[model samples]
Target: MIIVDPSSGTSPDRIESFSLESDHSIIVTSLEHHVWQELEQEIVCSLKRLQCPRLLDSTVLLLHKLITNIVRTMHRHAFQQAIEDDLNIDIVSKDNVFDELLQNELNTHGDRNIEQFCRKNHFQVTLTFPEKTDTLIRIEYPESCDSSAYLDSKLAKAIGFTLLKQTDTITPAYYCATVVRDIAQHHPHLEQAGHSELLLPDDESDKVLAVFCKLNYGIIVFSSAGDILSISPAILNNLKLEISPTSAHTLTGIIPGHFYNDVLWGLALQSQGGLFENYRIRIRLPHDDSLSILFNISGYRHHDMTIHTLWQIVSLDHKATHTLAEGSILNEARVHNITRNYVPQLVEQKAREIVRLGGNALLNEECRLAVLFCDIAGFTSYVENNEKEESVIHTLNMILGRITKAVRQHAGIIDKFMGDCVMALFREPHKAILAALEIHKHSYDFNNLRMRAGKDLLLLRIGIHWGKVVIGNIGSSDRLDWTTIGDVVNTAARLEKNCCPGAILISETLYEITAHMDHPEIRFSKPFYLKLKGKRNKQAVRYVQTTSQTLLHDIFTTHHAKG
Candidate 1:
């Protein structure tokens, strides 16, 4: 059993040195009532001694539930192993007999047999305090024991219940950390035992493809010989294509005359591993109306060296038609490069928005949004002082990656990244604050790594505000930038500029909205006034405080003392 004393000034590098420590180990050899009572008493005393009354009851209850389930599962496995050894046969082949004997022994003997069995196959539980803020419980089983059974059992349900019950009491960071840790521990077992191979069979793949073709876009599959193999109903309906008994089912015969030559040329180019996309054409409809369509073709080579072409046709709106008519269609190679490189950086919501809007027209609208700005403190000095340009850029990207992840996790849209700052927009005021908290937490870890490496620690200052903002395209005709504008954006930036290092500053407007919600993790100071730039009157604001602030301070103090 290993336990690190929180008051010992133990760093992460020294964790392995304390592996032999056994100050927090509890040995369980039976499930009898008196044993549980004694164990609970010890746990209660420990909690009291630690002065962690906030988590006392919940921790006790959760540990009890978890241990109960674990012990039961262990006993069942041990019993099966005993039967198999005595009978010299696989227990699965004697399921009925094993079940009858198991029931009789459990109900009649009442832990007498299981208690003796557990005495030979016992496990130890150890409790550790991580950063003196969270509890880490570990159960260690013997080499011959199968601990995976307990992990795969009802332990997750117990953890879930504890989290739900303590939602309003525990911090969000702790809650998320617990959930993620549990998932990571069991993920390998889940993949090996619970889930099947991810790749679908041929029939399943065909069924999926059939369903996918029924969506809004038109799909057509053809062979290298220009023979139409399959086409979606959407294609025929949207293009008003009618098939007669005498009509040939070939690309040349079925395709419209206006775009047949272009389609053929595109397919020929695709055969040489060249991409063909954004080929625009006009399809004449009834009543002299015309519809603009964009074509994207992809080719797949089969094992038999046969090429299968997949053609996608998207109908364009009036705005997209005008934009395309202005000769703005990108070259196929540029389109391919952009899709492969830049498109993946877009968030899922932004990607969907672009697809829905057909990537055309000015998206000018006024909506109430929460704006967040995050800037790294002392970054300029660090960059100027550090001669290793590559290391500086790497560190900058690492920090920016953490901030980007936090915003994306909270469903916020990243507007842009300035030199040492990031701007994001969120629809929910509470989520924006949550994202800010997450960014600071991640930065704390980064700073710890930097401190250990004898590098200067980087701190972040964040600001969030909620108000109506204009979000749309703003730039020259050649290069348009999709961003947020209005006083709200300016206020968020100003707040960030005036914020203290390693802290978050939020306007009262945002504070009021989030304070009314069920977010006990977020705490704020008394209302304060700030003379923000470009404003006639002082703006009302508050300093956002979190439990992590204390943790960060402890780390800083400990590191500096050691230095």
Candidate 2:
């Protein structure tokens, strides 16, 4: 057993690379949730921006999730134990390893214990948590043929914590299991009914499934009596794209939605108890069972009146993707099993992109990548001078709306949009450089409109850098973001600061690359050296501006002038 108690100043990012397979059971504690969450978002952003999974695979991402779950769970247990001891609530969340359950002092914390118990233990007890969240995770094995043995009685009845795994493997299993005993020692309000089955709240059920689908499917929800409750935007976007070519190409137009009511209604009504168990259903309209939209629907009851359910709908192409290696059709149970494990939305989206690329987009080697960082000139002053929040939002959106279009036009990924800045990544260095030049032209168009409306001009400053940076996910669980890190990304942002209003700056490395490209739009104003802030040594840099021809072409090509 090993214990790691990090000091207050220690960065949680240091623990991001924690190994899943360990020779020793480890207890990691004391990291604050807020700090860890911040680090996680940074790592997530980097991993997504870099597309690290193509090389590092999904294991790194999964390990992140495991470590985070451990830390969060451990914290909760310790907090709960302290709370019970202090409040005298008659509630006890005992720390139970599989070996200790038979001897636990189980009482009725009621069925809530079932959830707590199932969250932490396994039947065979191949793995058990000391912190449950921190010390133990069974990544080595994810399946079990039989259920673990345990005694069920009043004195041993309370199962404190439970979290089940809904995976697609043959050996589907549970994460944690334990018994919680009420002891009837306190808290009269919680024991009014004596024992009530733990049902997930309406909002919570939707939340858990939404979290699950982040990396997985397009979900369709239906009420118990066959009413459509909700539809994900992704499905709706897919339907629109399929139904009409004249559909607007705005990125927002393609939101997920699930309109397949017949399939969902069938699943709910067929469920024995007002709830539909986890099962698979074919998505076919009344006139068309031939369409290959197969989805896995899992049903749960919110208030005994309505059945809330959703499916992991895979094929957005309106064709079937449910065939296995053996050429056999995937059954309902099998489909549900496969999708049981939570897959991040980014991962699934990336996977589909690779598929669309005909499997050649996956790259592992260091590619000469370009990082572009753009910010609104004097955003703080713009906000401070403009007292109305509405004007600030309107102007900011107007600028961002134009900037985002410019970035995508050049095949760049807007890694993230900060309050008034955006970070874009490009495999082609020139695109990043070109994107910067085009953005300034766009500013002119917006300024033209603003001048007509008697408003202040909004200027743009952009910085571009060229270097090899890794794209790797850094944080735990679903709280991940896509970003790229390294000197290149940092240097680009630094360059942006040095840029003049309505101008673009390029690092020496970027100048060397673009200097050779044949484009009349790019012009550099001789190399110079500067002792940039926080840097000890002088570095070579160059200033750049695109010609009218370039901006005009971009304007006419993509119709970027916002009306």
Clashes of each: 0, 62
| lDDT of every model, 2 decimals | 0.60, 0.51
Model 2 Cα RMSD, Å?
Answer: 22.4
On lDDT, the candidate that comes out on top is: 1
lDDT of 1 by residue, 1-563 (tens): 12233345764223322322235444554444223333444555545544443444555555555565555656666788778778888776237877788878876665557656655544322223232322344444333223321332354443322221122322221111121123334444532434566556987898777766665555555554555566655655565556532222533463555343444444444445533445555444432354444554444444443345455555557546544431114554566576754432323444444344234343344456789999988788888878564488888888999999999899887888898899998866789988988898898888888787887777888999887676555688887676778899999999999998788999998876666667676678899899999999999999886865766855765654464
Instruction: Write candidate 2's Cα lDDT for 1-563 as tens digits.
Output: 12223433443322322332343233333221112222333334334443332322232233334444444344344345444566777444444542143223122221123323333332112222222221212322223311222222221223111223434434454233322223244333434544666657997799877787775655444455454455556554533333332332321222222322433444344556545543544434323435545555565555555656554665445543444211113344577578844443334555564454234232222224688989987789778977574478887888887887888899877777789998888766778877877787788777667656755556788889887565545465657543466777788888888887677888887776656678875678799987677667776888887666345334432332332
Q: Highest TM-score, which number? A: 1
Model 1 ranges off by over 4 Å: 1-351, 354-362, 554-563
TM-score of each: 0.45, 0.39
Worst 10 residues of 2 by lDDT: 154-163
